[model samples]
Target chain A: MIIPAKSRLWSTVAVFAVAVGLTACQTTGGDAYRAPINAAKTQTADDPDKDSGAPTDVSGDSVARDDGDSGITGSIDDYRIEDLSPGERPDISSDEASVWMIADRAERRAANAGNAIKDPALNAYVSDMVCKIAGDYCDDIRVYIVRVPDFNATMSPNGMMSVYSGLLLRARNEAQLATVLSHEIGHYLRRHSYQRMKDTIDKTNGLAFFQVFTAALGVPVVGSIATIATVGSLASFGRDSEREADGYGVLLMARAGFSPHEAPKIWENLDAELGDTPRSRSFFYASHPAISERQTMLRALADEVPIAGGGPGRIGTEEYREALSPHWESLLADEVSKRDYERTERLFDALIADGFRAGAVYYQKGEMYRQRGDEGDEDLALAAYHAATQFIDAPPEVFRARGQIFQRRGLNVEARESYAEYIRRNPEATDRKMIEFVIGGLGS
Target chain B: MKKLVRIAALASVLALAAACQGYTLVKGGSPVEVGNAMKVSPERSWSKLTSGKYEIWTVDGPILQQILFASGVEDGEKLFPTDAQTPKTLPEFKKGMTELEITELYRDTLVQLGGTQFEIQEIAPKTIAGKQGFRFEFTFATKEGLQKNGIAEAVLAEDKLYFVAYTGAKLHYYPKNLPDAEQVMGSVEIL
Candidate 1:
């Protein structure tokens, strides 16, 4: 927990300086920071510390109130689609423009420095999906698919949207994917980032200013960590923004002819995946509305606006599965590597329920069981691997896994046969010499 | 807040002073004993660092390319230092671990070190220190976005794990030093 002090000091100083500069130069007309139209609809205020397993009585209540404009009010039903065309840029103050410029530069630098997935077809597919929901605002937003294995996405004030692969992997269908994308787009359209920044600066007195400076430096991790540290109190402010975004996102999906039910289903799946794990309180979940709360509110909203045709509308599950087919193994591998056994097991169960990529799902389940190595885990692993082999697209590693288990049990003949099959299937296997050596020993 | 600032400033000064100390130079074509359990011969000279439990060696620089030797790590002992009170937990080396389980231990270690995007490219049985062992190839990206490639070999002898890992930046350093690492691994001998 002891971070490098030098880096922390630099980050704190940098953020503080930027916040002060932005505050002094503020000249924006109109309420750029508006309270959520649906604040009353949200049952409880967001308390990240409470959700994160920390005591709720932590100090800094004053900092929590600085989340920009809290007086501007309306209901979720009061929102009307604005003129979001590329030609009709939203009004911005000079100070807001400066923040946007910095964000634009940082995003461009990040695009070059970070591992961006360069799959044109995948990018185009995602962009098209976002456009369907974005309407006229589609041209104002550019999508960047990053290669990180964490379930999150963000939209900066500069109109750059990053979709992490983890989110894509977790999403079961196009509707689910659209739900997340539209939520981020809601943040963009509402100008939440700008408002949040202003609030942070105003509340901290001087401590929060360093956050803005670090963000401007474009040292990715430092800036991000600093923002998280200083912006802890801003979670209440963020909760309001998130609630607003959720409302907006549902409207977007329903209008775009996608099933709104998928929105809540995303959270339901996530809730199940998290179960009672400590990760339920992790930053990813903490910064957003509680999953159960989101699921309930979204369900209510979806019920209010039933699909026009009475049909389920476009779930796009088949198309989504096909599009992500090439990346499935790698995505699944990333999930398995996290070693969160319960979460991974639930994920595999969900995938199996969908009946897509059953072979790979079975294989991954086997891997989880094998890695857990509990008393009865070996039997479970063997059963899962055996099931995997029945499917056409089962990974070749299934044979090797079987061979190892048999070898452990001193079933030499079975192990040798399994190893031989593995060698036959994977002629260019990197561990061919080792497998061959095992076979040689079995012969003796 | 002021107290935090002072403590941080003091820590920074100490860190700077520590960095000023140079590494111990290891001559090429010389045999080296790693920890108390294993020895290896290096064909080329390297710089050695004794920071924690492992003996670290670097050719170009630790950031670009390095080798780690962990010898005689006992049961319930952490491979790296960690604060007991921290929420993050490090995996410990345990006796009676299968090859797959041992690899998982290494994977967990890498994750603790901020290698979130770690992938095992290959794992197979191999001979190390003239005894049955396992070797694994992996790739990972650091939090700072540096992609790394690594190869590791380990054996459990006398109920303790003896391990060596070579890692380098995937862009250029990995391919450049892979042969030298292979040669070093080949020369390993358990006392």
Candidate 2:
């Protein structure tokens, strides 16, 4: 059950009280936000938008220490991507095990959802391009083309690379995709995941980090134990990992012959896409350098590489748009469900403006209206839904919405027919049960 | 000159080998096996399974590779929560289900976990425990080196219906583990 916002905060306080009560004997760290030690806090806790009075500086310079600092020396060689096959690389026994587990779990969940694209051509294109640019540095890495509409990429500790579909959509060319992928590759090579995990353990557990890893249960088990058994609070690693990845990613992009400046440009788009969303994704905050910070870094790094004469860099723009064309309506539907009406409406208008006529746009407009309800213009919604149904290939959602409209207007038979058509078309839909129940309520 | 060239090649090989020496990768050993088959059917009055206790199974082969418990089991109910009012959000349980909704449920989970692209193999009808159901094969890649591949069996039986999901790697490792999973499925019985 979802807690009301006020109660949620107080519930969190209660949870905090229980946690403190449970761990009262343990020594509290200086200037530390006492970690909640309860199952409720662990599983259901949301990532807070602002820091809880914790001191953090997200600048790139924080991780780059002087030469005498443990011999790291900020040398170029330290960040080079080591060429190691999957079997050759050392086990990530020291990394944040929870993050890897979550990533793995997410992958499994994706596979289970049947949300994968079966296009071998697209997969091969991405894989080939990524390897050509970054393969020499690492060999055991795996690439996945996820069907998400957001422009993002993530590199997991286990060398699992997930590229969002939106990235494919937004990139000006193959070079742009390579620039982002190369940047992520840099994160893996620089051992950011491992370091972050270690840093988390160090900060939270103090001297107990060594004990946790060396337990008789084994490291993976220890990691899982930490996540499952202990309070799974939001564990953001110290700033070192993000800066390291950013620095290394920029270098990789530059070496691979893409404009390093594109990295920051990507972030600028990302920030705009986010608009006024209160909290940014944890991965972006956790792993990626800030957009402004990254933009500045990339501009400075641009000095090392030649600013080449321009070419028509609209790499795969047409193909990207074409491939996504079939799923445009569905993607819009998904965005609408997430209550991202602005993005949904914008995309709808873009498709219409791009000559995608027929009832798809009209129907989507109607769907957006219904979603808005009291917060939206209902008259426009009714007009759009009616206009949408006039098309030859109207989707089940349109019929369903029309059915709801009919039901509201006291047209029982018409509503039943519409609902029936919707149910028939979307037999595999998640809402089938509810629709069936609704149809049942309409009576024979 | 030939002898000198051979020495240089050997030196380079040794250097490469040394660079790899830092990683003690745990690899092939005796193949792991599922010793006993246990079927978990929701029909035989589930007083034990959903008793708020996580059931963990211990097996051997790979380190830390243990069979975990599938929590919150019930007949004709979803393992995870979805909006009940939204019929389109959940699929139809026709006949009642051609394929278990595990794939469907798992995909939803992925989106929550920041999955941008998720997909699955085609689903078809099948039978388990002498009742009609469906089988779905699926694969996914993520930022971590975890290539999770899975198959789920949604079966029906007298007074009970449920699904069994077996997941492992998409590589050579999956084949090695499938038999163990099968053995476990075979072992499971209403308890």
lDDT for each candidate structure: 0.66, 0.47
The segments of candidate 2 whose C-alpha lies over 4 angstroms from its true place after superposition are A1-44, A48-88, A91-122, A145-152, A164-176, A201-262, A281-289, A296-314, A323-400, A411-444, B1-191
TM-score for predicted model 1 compared with the true structure: 0.78
Top candidate on lDDT is 1
Tens-digit per-residue lDDT, A1-444, candidate 1? 333433322222222211111110110100011111111122232322221111111122323422455332323473456624454443577556656756676566556532577689998999999888888788888888877555677677767787878788889999999888878778777777667666545545343444344345432222222233222221333666777778878878878888988989888887777777674456445456677777877888877765646777689999999999988877777677666678788888988888898998898899888767789998999999999999988888888888888887888898888889888888988768767876887752
Model-by-model DockQ, in order: 0.19, 0.02
Which segments of model 1 are wrong by more than 4 Å?
A: A1-76, A83-93, A112-116, A147-150, A219-237, A277-293, A303-312, B1-13, B51-53, B75-89, B96-108, B116-128, B132-140, B175-183
Clashing pairs in model 1, backbone N/Cα/C closer than 3 A? A14-A210, A14-A213, A15-A209, A15-A210, A15-A211, A15-A212, A15-A213, A16-A209, A16-A210
DockQ of 2: 0.02
Which tens-of-lDDT digit does each residue in A396-433 have in candidate 2?
67777777766655677987898788878888865555
Clashes of each: 9, 38
Positional deviation of residue A72's Cα in model 1 after best superposition, in angstroms: 11
Residue-level error in angstroms, candidate 1, position A170: 2.8
lDDT tens per residue, model 1, B122-159: 87788787789989898876544567889999898988
